[model samples]
Target: MTIERTEPATDAAERTMLEGWLDYHRNTLAWKCEGLSDEQLRTASVEPSELSLMGLVRHMAEVERGWFRKVLTNEDAPPIYYSDEDQDGEFHLTESDTYQEAFATWQAEIETARRNAARFALDDLSEGKHRRTGEQFNLRWIYTHMIEEYARHNGHADLIRERLDGSTGD
Candidate 1:
């Protein structure tokens, strides 16, 4: 599939601009992984790191579900890729992990995230509290954090892609 990413609008409403950049970073991740085989997707960035494009995809799936489904709506959303016993399960690749399943789950979570976020205004408070501090968060904070999450991970993806086949771009 062809992954297309648009530059976030320079002049737009806050919500529109936020979503645009969020999506741009989302597609940037996809673009970095484009045309690679399952083995490539599963390849780790370096020894002892266990960081792979596939891992990032799975990790983001968990992040989306955690923030949008659990935090935003207080739905009974559980971690799909991790557990209390293995918090970093998403970053650890098993032999059976595949690109198809990882991408499908991530995309599905993205859709759910969009739907959940649509139910609230940017100023709306989330139903869930912060796991670390017990602080409340607004939808606007979630959007900004999600964008930062994607942007940071996308940078890792750039290096991984470059290592995989020397392909690089912003």
Candidate 2:
């Protein structure tokens, strides 16, 4: 499943509009995680939920990998996050991994996603079919879906980070 991206947009305005939403979503999620201590970042709100600042960062790494690389780019690389295994890998409760490591992974994944997205014109229809559903979605639609998903999670991150510490937006 190779993703062949065609240049679909002929104008600058269209390109900027598409890029803006991607930028907006990335910033929103990062803003939610800003200014917290290691302890604060690791704290989950309560039992029965695995969400935490660190966990979100790890999960989003996998999210980026899934949508951009696997789905959009049609890469066969395994998704970054594992459900049955790698439990501690994302939540990362141990003192072994630093904030920098988790943050870096997210950054690198986003950059990879950005490069893949840039391969196409903003509205270009995707060349690869979705792996699971075999449905077709344009590059534009994928960007919009990512923005919506990240925005939703970022809201949850906002409340969690707030509780972790009084620190707020960047």
Candidate 3:
């Protein structure tokens, strides 16, 4: 079950470049989880930390929903796996959680994010305000931020995957 990742195009427009990098990072995360069982995916192989590949998948789904559906498009979207009471639930998995469900939700959120993003131009302002500062952001800023988020998390994913099975690559 090897996951296939596409390399970003060297020469492209701003949107194409941004999206290509983002998709690359996204697939990189999935690639890290490939060929692992549910328990393997949920293992906190990174000692002294609770981060797992499944947790990263869940976290990214929440991120996609939060930024795209909740903020960008102003949809009444709520956290998929976490709440105010359990803020880190996405990273706190149980035996009941399945990798299939987690991956499906993550993929669905990714698709929704793309659809929601299509409604606005790069310079268009988000319909919702930032939770911390109450300031609005443009779509371009959101895209850049999302790319950064994925890139950072994918690095974590790489470390975790390598620790799990001694596998490593871009």
Candidate 4:
């Protein structure tokens, strides 16, 4: 994944540490999607691959909901993109959606995540019993993991976008 310097263009400016790393990541993620019209962004790498840019957008939104809202807040909220019957629904891309539809949903979810994250103290803890191990976890772990999760998938998305077009770089 390309990381564009969020630094000010001039050398005289004193740069703050962690300056726009998160914003850089967010913009870089969006930058990978630049210049692709609706149809191209929604295109899949291969038929039946269950990997599409649109799906990644939705999946990341779901992840933010899962970690920041449900897990971080320890709410009993049901999984946003999960299904007990078929676990892979989150991976399935909706080709029928217009560009406006996909992006609008994504924008809404991103806002929700940001709002929830803003509400928490830095040391917030999750109160739920684990689904597999039946243990409790602090929200700290969930937040760290969410950052890692987004970074990792953002790498995957970079490659996908590269394949779509020659415009590559943060």
* Clashes within 3 Å, all models in order: 0, 0, 0, 2
Top model by TM-score, which number?
A: 1
Q: Write the per-residue lDDT of candidate 1 for residues 51-163, one digit (tens) a residue.
A: 99999999999999989988888888889989999999999898899999999999999999999999999999999877777877899999999999999999999999999
Is 1 or 2 the stronger prediction by TM-score?
1
What value of lDDT does candidate 3 attain over all alpha carbons?
0.90
Once fitted onto the true fold, the runs of candidate 4 whose alpha carbons sit more than 4 angstroms away are: 1-20, 79-82
* Candidate 2 Cα errors over 4 Å, as ranges: 1-12, 83-93, 168-170
Which segments of model 1 are wrong by more than 4 Å? none
Q: Best to worst by TM-score, what's the order?
A: 1, 3, 2, 4
Clash pairs of candidate 4? 125-139, 126-139
Instruction: List the global CA lDDT of all models.
Output: 0.94, 0.73, 0.90, 0.62
TM-score of 3: 0.96
For residues 40-153, write the lDDT of model 3, one tens digit per residue. 999996668999999999999999998998789888988899999999999999999999999999999999988988899999999997777887889999999998999899
Models ranked on lDDT: 1, 3, 2, 4
What are the per-residue Cα lDDT tens digits for candidate 2 across 95-137?
A: 6655677888888999998899889765676666677788766
RMSD of each predicted structure: 0.8, 7.2, 1.1, 5.0
Candidate 2 vs candidate 3: which has greater lDDT? 3
When summed lDDT is taken over every stretch of 10 residues in candidate 1, the lowest stretch is 128-137
In candidate 3 the C-alpha lDDT for residue 93 amounts to: 95
Q: Which candidate is the best by lDDT?
A: 1
